[model samples]
Target: MNISVNSLNMPLLECFGSETRVRMIELLSRQPMNIKELADALQLSSAIITKHIQKLEENGIVGTESISGTRGRRKVCYLIPDSIVLQLKAPEPPEEHGGSGYAVSIPVGQYERCSVKPTCGLASENGVIGMVDDPRYFSDPEHVKAKHLWFASGFIEYRIPNYLVGRQTVTSFSLSLELCSEAPGYNEHWPSDITFSLGDTVLGTWTCPGDFGSTPGVHTPKWWKLGTQHGLLKTVTVDERGTYLDGVRLSGLTSADLAIGPGRELLFRIACPDTAEHPGGVSLFGRHFGNYDQEIEVRIGYE
Candidate 1:
C-alpha cells in the first residue's frame, strides 16, 4: 500500500489519537495478519478489533485483501503507508526577495520508466511484491507501494514535475534518497559505482561501499529476513555553482547544463553504468522500509 499526503494538519492527528490504533499499526507493520490473528495477539474482542480496523482502513492507514480459506475467504490486513510527510505551504516571496520555491516528494516505486535486470525485485514493509529478479513483476499494479527495490544492473528514471519554474529562475535542484550496493545476498565490503543524471547531463558518480545487512535497519520490519535489510541515505545536489554529493563538490556541471525551462521536464536517472570498475549493484529505499523515514525528496530553489 502506498499513500502520499500534501499536509497533515488534522485528519492525521485524529487517526493516531487512539492507543489501540497505534498498537495495531505496530503489529501490522511487521507482517500481514487476519482480523482474528490481530484480535488474539492484542487480546481484544472481535467487535473492538473490527471497529479499529474499519477506522484505520477508512483513514488510509491500513489495507485489506481476501485470501482463500477453509470455508470461504479470509480478510488479511496490512499497513498501507511507508511514511507521511507534513509539507507546509511555501510562502510567496516578497518583492525584494525576487522569487519563491517549493519542494515535492515522490514515492520510490512511482518511477516513470525503468530497465531493471536479473537479481532485481521490489518489496513493501510487509512482504515481497512478486518473485525476486522477475522483471515482469515490475509492472505489477501493486508496485506503487514498494518501499524497497534492487537490481544487479540497469536504471530507474523519474520525471520531476516543474512547479512554478516559469515565473522564477531555478537556483538549485536536489534529490535526497536512500541507497546502497547490492549483492546476491548481503556483502559488507562490495563496491558499486552509482551514477546520477539530469536530462542528458551526467552529474557524476558515487561509489557505494557495499550491500548493508550486518544489522537491522532502523525502520526495517521485524519479519524481514536477516540477510536483506536497509540502505544508506544519500543526498545529491546541483546548483548554479556545481554538482555536489552531501555538500562536497563532485563536478563542475551547473544548473545551466541541465537546460531547465518552461514546459521542459526534468528527467532524473539512477544507473549502474556497465563500464564501471565495480558494477556491484544498487538498491533504493523508501520511507517505512529503510532507516530514513522519508521518501525521495526533490527540492527546487528559485531566485
Candidate 2:
C-alpha cells in the first residue's frame, strides 16, 4: 500500500525533530542500510537505535525487513518510507494558471530560424538567443547524421506563469544544456566560460572544460564526422540559494532573497563570449534527453 501523511499537525513535525531521527532519515535517503550499519555510523547502541526505529515505524515514517542468511538465520533492520507525502491543512485551492512546467528538445534537426550560408547554427528550443553556430562544425539535423558537433552558445527562454502568486515560493529552479569541443582535429582539455541571467540581473557564470569529443555517442547519426565530441553543461540548481554546474557548487546567486511568486516570470539566458578563442557552444538536452530531469520547474510549499 502507498503510505501517506496523516496531517501537518504539531505532532507530525515533532517526529522529525530529534537529531538522531533526523540523521537516521538523512542516511536512509541515500539507500537502505541495516540496523548494524546505522548503529555503527551513528555511534549509538542497537537498543537505542531500535527505540528510535520503533517510533518511526509506528508513525509509518519507516519500515523494517528481515533477510535470511545462508545459515537460515535472519537479520532485522529498518528502512525509510519509499516516498513522502506532505499533507498540508491549508485552505488554498489548487493552482489554476494556464502555463505549466515543460520540457522541450532542440535537436540539430530542429531549429526555429536556421541558415547555412554564414555558419551552421539553430535557435534553441525556446528561441531566446539568436545567431548560434560554429565554423568547425556543420552537421545540421536537417540532413546529416552527426556523431559530434559544437556551437558558440545554446539557450532557451521560458515564460513563468502569473497565477502562483501567493500560494508558494520558487524554492529551486534549474536549466540543462549539452557542451562539447569547439574545433575539429583538436582534442584536449579545452575550457570555456558561460554566463546566465534572469531578466536584466546576471545570475551566475561558469567555466566549462572541453572534456567531450567525437567518441561515438548514443543519439548521434552514423554518418557523423570522426572528430565530433560533446558534454552537457547542466546548471541544475539555480535559485536564490546559489547555482551549480553539474553537481559542483559555483559562486554567485542567492536563493534567500529571490521573490519567485506569481507576478514574476523567469527567463534563463546563457552566453558563451565570442572571444573564448576556443569558442565551443552547447547542445540543449530538454525533456527529450532527460539529463537534468526538468526543462524548467518552480517549487513552492505551504504549511
Candidate 3:
C-alpha cells in the first residue's frame, strides 16, 4: 500500500516513532502472527504488543483476520502493505511577476501514439473495454473512456498542447499521473524501470517498486477484479533548475533543454526501455481508477 501525506508530522510520527512499533512492523513483514506469537517473537508482554497492534491497525498499516483455533477462533495480524511511499509535495516558489501560465488535463487513455505488447489491456470505470493482453483494443474508439491501461513493455506517447509559449514565458512544465510497475498477475516485489521523455530530452527514469494488488485501489471501480488493480500517483516536473520526481530533483535537464516554441506540440512519452534492468512493465491509472482522483495533469508555469 502507498501512503501520501503533506507532512511528516502528526499521525505518521505518532504511529512509527516508537522503536517497538518499528520492530513490530518488521516482524509482520515476514508473515502474519497472533498476539501470542508476536509477543514471544519480540519478547514483549501481551499488553505492549496489543497496544502497538492497535495503533498500527488504526493507521491502516496492519490488518487482522479471525481464524479457527483450539479455542474456537482467534485473530491473526498481518501487514496491510508490503511497502510505503511518502510523496512530499514540493514547496511552492514565491510569487514572481504575477506567475501566469495554463494547465491542461488529458484523459489517461487518449494517447496519440503507442506500441504496447501482450499482457496489455484497457478498462473503463464500469468494466473492461476489451480483451485482456490484446493490443488492438488500445485503438478502439472507446479507449477515450479507459480509466486504466497496462503493458509488459513498450511505450505510450501523448501530445500536450503548448499553451504558454506565445502568451507567456514558460519557466516550467509539470506532468502528474498515477502509475506503477506491471506484472503478469500481481507481484509485490516486482520492479520496473519506467522512463519519461519530453520531446527528444530524456527526463530520467524511476524504478517502480511493484505492481500493487491484494487491496483494492482507493478509487478503483468495484466491478474491477482484485488482482488487476495497479499503479501509484506520481508527478514529474521540468523547471528552470532541473527535472524532478515528486519534488525531488532527478536530473540536470532544465526548461531550456525543452525549447518550447509557438505552434509546437510537447510530446510526452512513458516507456519501459528494452535495456532496463527490471523490464517488468507498466500500469497507468486515470481519473476513475487508482488511488488518486485526477488524470494526466500538465501544468505550465510562466513568468
Pairs of residues at least 3 apart in sequence or in different chains that clash in candidate 1:
none
lDDT tens per residue, model 2, 1-303? 111244423443566879999899888777767777889999999888878877765444555555776767443443423333343443233343433332333333332222222223433323322233453234334322221223544442334333454555555555445544344332334556656666666666655544333233334334434343234434345555576554456666655455666667555455555664544544433332211222333333221
Query: Considering lDDT, where higher is better, how would the candidates rank from best to worst?
Result: 3, 1, 2
Off by over 4 Å in 1: 1-99, 165-167
Best candidate, lDDT-wise?
Answer: 3
Task: Tell me the whole-model lDDT of each prediction, alpha carbons only.
Answer: 0.77, 0.47, 0.79
What TM-score does each of the candidates earn? Answer: 0.67, 0.45, 0.75
Report clash pairs, candidate 3.
none
Q: How many pairs in model 2 have backbone atoms within 3 A of each other, for residues 3 or more apart or on separate chains, i.e. clashes? A: 13
Model 3 misplacement above 4 A: 1-99, 165-167
Q: In model 1, how large is the Cα lDDT of residue 70?
A: 94
Two-way lDDT contest, 1 vs 2, winner: 1
What does the lDDT come to for candidate 3? 0.79
Candidate 2 stretches greater than 4 Å from native? 1-119, 123-150, 153-163, 184-186, 275-279, 283-303
Model 3: weakest 10-residue lDDT segment is 90-99
Model 2's C-alpha root-mean-square deviation from the true structure amounts to 14.4
lDDT of 3 at 194: 97
